[model samples]
Target: MSAPDQLLVVIDAVARRSDGESVRIAKDVLCAGAAVKLCLPDTPAEFAKALARRGSRRPVVIGDDRALVRAVGLLHRGRELSDGALSLVPVGPHGSVDLAGALGVPLGAVAAARAVLDGAARRLDLLVDDSDGVVVRGLRVPAGPSGLAVIEPGSVWDTCRSLVRTLVRPAPSVPTIRTHRLRVEADGRVLSDLDDPVEGVTVLSRGGVAEVVVRPRAAEPVRVEASAVTISGASFRYRADALVTGPVWTRTWTVRPAAWSLTLPAA
Candidate 1:
């Protein structure tokens, strides 16, 4: 049998504690229709080990976005993502598993689990950073103050939470999407230089290239599609999905076109 027919379901511990009911539901649903091997990992180390030993079974991650990202990151780092063919069942606190939903994974515990059993494998794009970190979701450089300010806004309390997830320190007040000086280059073409203040930058995976948008402080949004992007300037942080990483002086990310595959609802 192929990996999808025989599954390895790795349930993240946080998801267990936060919402055991959802986790249990996911387990029951997945087990009902497939040959399942379930593993509940307490630490990240154990989780990585589970994935490493997944063998020929499709790995269905039962947790929030962070857990899902962790699994994808591990497979990417190990150079196994090209054939990983992962699935997800979002079971966590509210607003935490938004990435899965955004990716078209069912939010409900039962529906998500069922999808895992019946969904079709679809190729997805990814952003691989120079640091070797993989971004399964889109990248965002939220418009911050003059200094380094990063935002991870995806919920109702975006402004309040964005202030807290800053690179240096929280802005005193939610400044009206202030300017940040960043030198952005997409495919070697300069979209914005350090001399030109920018509101921020967003790079979303599109087919084979990333849709790069540089929000200039004074000019219209500069847009381009590139396989690689380089950003340099004063130290700044950025949100790569659930993680807020950086404060680095510079960074580069190249699109790994159709780098990985996911199990989404079958048409």
Candidate 2:
């Protein structure tokens, strides 16, 4: 398809802070001469509605990483991810837009918005889990005595405590780290057996395969590449993208090559 000249700007509620910077970014997009339809969605339902009504306009998400994930999930669910490319303007506190940075999106609102007007669409891979959860970046299965801590969003006290601990304490030692006995399978082959104690596991989709890295207690890390991976153990938690999930026995993720497209500055 040809490049989109009409755009749909969806601003998440959280990014509506900072003296209406999200709105100003939309205005900047409009001033650049693209036909823009701006929507300030305050809730998840509203966000869905706005996207559903996007018509032919290309979508530009104005918010943090979660907002981008929400839009991508909606598009993927609607089977429209391959139909058009999505753009993003990272609008939040300094460290909140890490995903955008990782995806090569300009950090500034104006630059990201302008990229929507004059950028190239690049197809990217995605990790689709068994439950249909999408992971854009990657995931980690922590190793330690406690394993991975469950961090719920909007818990101010928990956030403060964690922050304080990080600032005050020395780095955790290997013995203090929680370890789990996980069975990791990559494309049907077992990379790590359940009998082995693992320090951590990380998987990232690169090229057309999922790069699986298993860190064992006293051995060099094991790395493998496959299109699919399955992790099963007694009960473990994993951090997928920016969300933490599970205490479940098994979770499988398949790599979808070029599953989605994003607009990024031209090389």
Q: Write the per-residue lDDT of candidate 1 for residues 1-267, one digit (tens) a residue.
A: 564589999999999999999999989988898999999999999999999999899899999888988998999999999875899999887778878988899999988988889888889999999999988868888523322233445654878666668756756685665788889999899989888998889998878899999988778998899999999999788888877787788889999989999899999
User: What RMSD does each model have against the real structure?
Assistant: 5.8, 4.0
Alpha carbon deviation, residue 1, candidate 2 (Å): 16
Instruction: Evaluate all candidate structures by whole-model CA lDDT and list the values in order.
Output: 0.87, 0.83
TM-score of each: 0.87, 0.86
Which has the greatest lDDT?
Answer: 1
lDDT of 1 at 171: 62
For model 1, what is the C-alpha lDDT against the true structure? 0.87
User: RMSD of model 1, in Å?
Assistant: 5.8
Q: Clash totals for all models, in order? A: 0, 5
